[model samples]
Target: MFILSGLFCIPTDWHVLIITFMNAKVESWCARPEQLSDMPVSTWKQLSGQVNQTCQIKNIDWDAVTNETDISGEFGMKDCTKWEYDDSQFQSTIIGDFDLVCGRDVLIDFAQTIYFVGMIFGVLTFGILADILGRKSVLIILLLFACLTGTITSQMPNFTMFAISRVVNAFFIIGIFETHFTYCIELVGGKWSTIIGMGMEYFWVIGWLILALLGYLIRSWRSLTLLISLPSLSAVFMIWLLPESPRWLIAKGKLDQAEKILREAAIMNGKPLPDEWKLKPVKDFENTKKTTIFDLFRTRNMRGKILILYYNFFVTAFLYYGLIFNIGDLGGDVFVNFAASGFLEFPAYGAAIFVLMKCGRRIPYGTSLILSGLFLLSVSFVPRGVYYKDWPCMVLALIGKTCVTFAFGALFVYAAELVPTEIRTSAIGSASFLGRIGGTIAPWVGKLSIYHPYLPVTIFGVNALIAGLVSFLLPETQGQELPYTIEESEKLELASLIAPSILKPAKSTQPMEQEMIEFNNIPEKVEENEEDNLSCYSGDSALSQKVCS
Candidate 1:
């Protein structure tokens, strides 16, 4: 089920990311008026004195100059109402098809911005629904509609319909990702959660690579959209293949269903459930208070953590998507650059997994963000003469992209571990909700290049630096079990505060080593209890053991 859930990443990621190509700015110039119809394009430019201008044409009467040559003089320029595009690279893009250039250029960014706005609502709404309706149902519903809406997006006859369909598609795309993330995490709750969570990004990278290939091959925005959208219909088969999250079922007091699923899993693994062990409701669930988004903010410690996570998530999305959307401006083949960017993420994710295990969550997460910022800042400083440009800036951007990708993959695991299971989906939803706000702003920020070439990177770099610093304020959840309730999550925050002192050496290194050994045995002691033993099936004990190993 976990592996199958990961497969959905390909289509979901493509749907969300294809916008980078769809709205790409193609080379364009002001169209010649009817009077200049007989003139060659180069002659028209020279005759009208409109060289190097995209949005303006010289306001000169050509009737008097019809028979004249060399009638050159300065003239006032007028904003171009119609444009022609160079279609050598892309046969058609939204920018060309809709004439989204110059004054209308911001609308290109606006389309992506509104898509992310829909993502904000998608995560929040579907997150709560996943928590209530069960993960399987939510995943199936999202997949079906996401595919449908994405296909409709390609058929939209006008910009208004295109934007509307994209918004709806974004809604389902984000929901599919969030719901699947929550489902996969819950399905494999033990030490494997980190691997499962971060590993999901590998599938995303696969989709990204394919997107680059598709974009290069198709060259038309509409066809590319149709190609990416149609394949997602295959994911609808998950209805039968996917199971309801056992952890969620138990939380909702449906023990029979939860037990049946657990038993099936145990049998498949050839580790039969112990007759003595039985399914039990989590003690936190019996209170009947109903988990809401407020539960995340109900306590002081969790509130601080959630807020910091929100900012980190915002920074992650801001820099990550900003860099991706600006691939065309990076001075290379857009397809190659996009593919290279995706390829570099493999190593980044590998490094993220290694550091997450060795350094724990907080240090590596914060450090990656800082490093990503530094690299982005360096991109602006690279000498910009013809001899020292392009490749250097591209190299720096790629490095920054790698670091941010590390942070991006790590943040998912870190955020999932921080929130308790009862409201886990909702909490992640809310964090992503805030993150989408940053994503919404990223396209507009990408447009800042018109003012200054380095302005966008500079802004992204500075924000990443601040966010990196803010990440240290968050508690680390590297070796700890996934919190099952609000109180457990709060206790994690409190424990993180005193953990250093608690493990402080009294005198010799030998004693500290011994203390570490004893500390590692704590879960073993907890496992002796029947109530606590049930956690093994749910993945907590297995996760703790894996972390320690």
Candidate 2:
């Protein structure tokens, strides 16, 4: 069921790339007046005297021009009142449909920024709601609303309505992403957590690949959007098929509900529930204070961790989306380049999982960021006019994409591991909110190429380097257990500082039992009656054992 829920990533991830095609630039020029309708296009261009211009045409008196042989002299240029577009590349797009050319071209970027702004709100709003309302209910709601908004987006008659629908669609899309991510993470533990967390990114890459194909085949933006959105309607039925997170149920003091879910899971796995097992709510579940984003900053150690996480998230989204949006400027077939970008992520994610499991999270993640920065920075120095220059630039950019993809996958698992379960979604949402801010600015920064082609890449590269350096300050969570509370998280930080080399699994050994018992405040006498002690403790025995260890 958890794996099936990952299908939501299709529309969510496809929306991110569809913007590239939706606002694609097409060949356009000032429309000839009705009086010159009989003239050849070549003759019309000669008269206009602004033949090369897309947004302006020379002020020409069509009534005075009687002969096609009459060549035009230089005339004052004027803003084009009407435009004609060539449909060779794109049959229709927001750019051509809305005449977002010349002075109004920036609206394309503005619309994308608005979409990301909505994503920021979605992450925060849905993250909190998932914790309070339960992940299952929130996900079902988001899926239904996302489908509705996405369908409405296709029927918008004007740019204003289109933008409004897109922003609202973006809101629900991110909500589904965050709620689903939190629920999936809560379902498993230990090595499975790493596998599930990083592995889920593959679905995102698949969506990207499929979007490239769809963009190539469907040249009309409205039709393409409707096609991609229809699949989500099927996912709305997940309310009946999906189960609530047992972990979240336990946290909310719904012991019976959690037990029922766990028992079913055990049965599905062909492993019967142990006769001695019991459902126990976390200690103080009723009295526990609700955690919010502010709680992440309450402790000195957590504050430092979250600050570094924010910067890393910002740089990741900035560089990732910046590179994607800039693909049109890479001097090649945009569809082919887009496909290559998505294809490279497969190996990148594979490499990420391998390294994350073997080498831990901090070093590999930080190094990937630094390496990607170097690749991006190198693209500027590859001589521009050389016959092979475009190839080198494309190669470097694709390599950077791979590196950044690796870093992105690793960061998701790492961030989830660092934050405690109680405030996990909120903390992830807060960090992701910073990422959306960076994503919002990426389009405008891509526009900086008008002044200097390398300016945006240089900025992305430098920010990545700085973020990579800061990432090392975060403690390694490679073999460590997921922290359930602020105090537990702080202990992991202190342990990393003190014993830096000892990387052990969370399972308790005889020698570590005393430390775990003291940390969890369990009486020594409880060790004599392990079965009774498990029943009295909060959360699952695995979690209690982790705490004890």
Candidate 3:
């Protein structure tokens, strides 16, 4: 009350002083709301220099004098009868323009969370459809539908309508992300998988850079959303360029189709097929046994491994996205902070490549997770509401962000290697399903900041720590052959856990290539039996047993 009194009651001497200051400035032009649009060319040219000083206010007390008489009386304040907004700012966001202030703020978080709900739905269905229908077709369809829905979202009339449109947009967007990663990796041959995967990953970084630039230039959320999704239209046309996944075709028992795609791929690369390469018709297709989610839990050790990996995936994704969407709470230029944090991802990916190659997967994976956890924990301790608070908080946050990104990159490859080939896709699909669950819950976790500023960051810290601890239990697959079957994977559990160093796969062995060729050459029952007999006579009983098994 005293503060309000001091504010409302200005001394007579100060009033005279303020009038004198106003008299000095009264000779110059002041840009009023009514006068802004009609200003002359010369006035418009000089307005930028004078506007910031006179137009914008650092503090506003909206309730001080709400009535029209009070606005026009001694203070001469602008009347805001229906709507209120500061006209001096360069851009207007959804929250600012729609008045999504204190009472309605949860709508923002809920809107974001609803998008993730769509993503969770997408994650469950897209991978299965991709495996069944074909990667190219699914990707094209997603691109078309996502582009359509995203454009609709931009034109929505209300927050509710906008949030609903985001759900549809998110469904197709997740499909775009998942299907494209799979399609691009399949298009590249085995020797170039790492290079192609890294290249594809760079597209996401470019996306971040583009988003930052667009947000700065296009302040309207509707315009920005449209611009961000416009690239999907281009993707729709890429149907002509993208080929179906040969590996997927082969798994679906379409050997002839797979062969045709691979032959075309070989021709495109200017690499002649091996003189011995032949498209033998596959009779006994191995893909007859359709793996289900239950397959992941059929065995005890496998179940434990899958559960642990899924937990790690969930925690890693939860913390990673929780930090990303909560950037507004850190108190700075949100664009600059988001861009700065996103820019670190490039170096993070590069570092991931280096560390994975030199040190191995587990070291980089576990260490990155632990370091990220520690950094986030440190962020919780930084003194808030003081000078230089943002600097320390931002630094720690960005560092944590980079580490989590690096760990995420490693986790993708590590998870693929941990599971056997027969159910590799299913295992990864399950892990991703869990990850999406975590992502869906992340925005709600971010809202906990309203209760306590430290709560969100502390949750991130705890998740990262838990993920880091669980990652150690995963076996290292560095320099080891990926297991092809359940029995083979079972044989490696003891060795993988006990002495991974003792079992180095021979470089001379081309088991993956051999496996591919062997699957392609599936023969008649009689011929297969004869081949088994020949293999027995040739003293390669283990190979025969493996093939027969």
What Cα-based lDDT does every candidate model obtain? 0.76, 0.76, 0.57
Give the per-residue lDDT digits (tens) of candidate 2, residues 1-549: 656788755676877678878987787777777767776667666567655666767666655666553544656777888877779889999988888988888798888899998898888888888877888898888877777887899899988999999899988888877777778877766555677788888888889899999999999999998888888777667777888876677666776887677657656655445555565556466677876678888888878889889999989988888877774465578788778777878999999888887777878888999999999999899877684557888788878978888998888898998987777777888888888888888878977889998898899889888898788777777656666666667775622433444343332222221211112222223332354544333333355453221
Root-mean-square deviation of every model = 6.0, 5.2, 13.8
lDDT of 2: 0.76
Q: What lDDT score goes with residue 298 in model 1?
A: 80
TM-score pick, better of 2 and 3: 2
Which 10 consecutive positions of candidate 2 have the poorest summed lDDT? 510-519
Supply the global lDDT for candidate 3: 0.57
Tens-place lDDT per residue, model 1, 130-172, is 8889888988888888779988988888889899998899888
Q: CA lDDT of 333 in candidate 3?
A: 71
- Ten-residue stretch with the least lDDT total in model 1: 509-518
Per-residue lDDT for 45 in model 3?
A: 26
Error of 3 at 348 (Å): 0.6
TM-score for each candidate, following the candidate numbering: 0.84, 0.88, 0.73
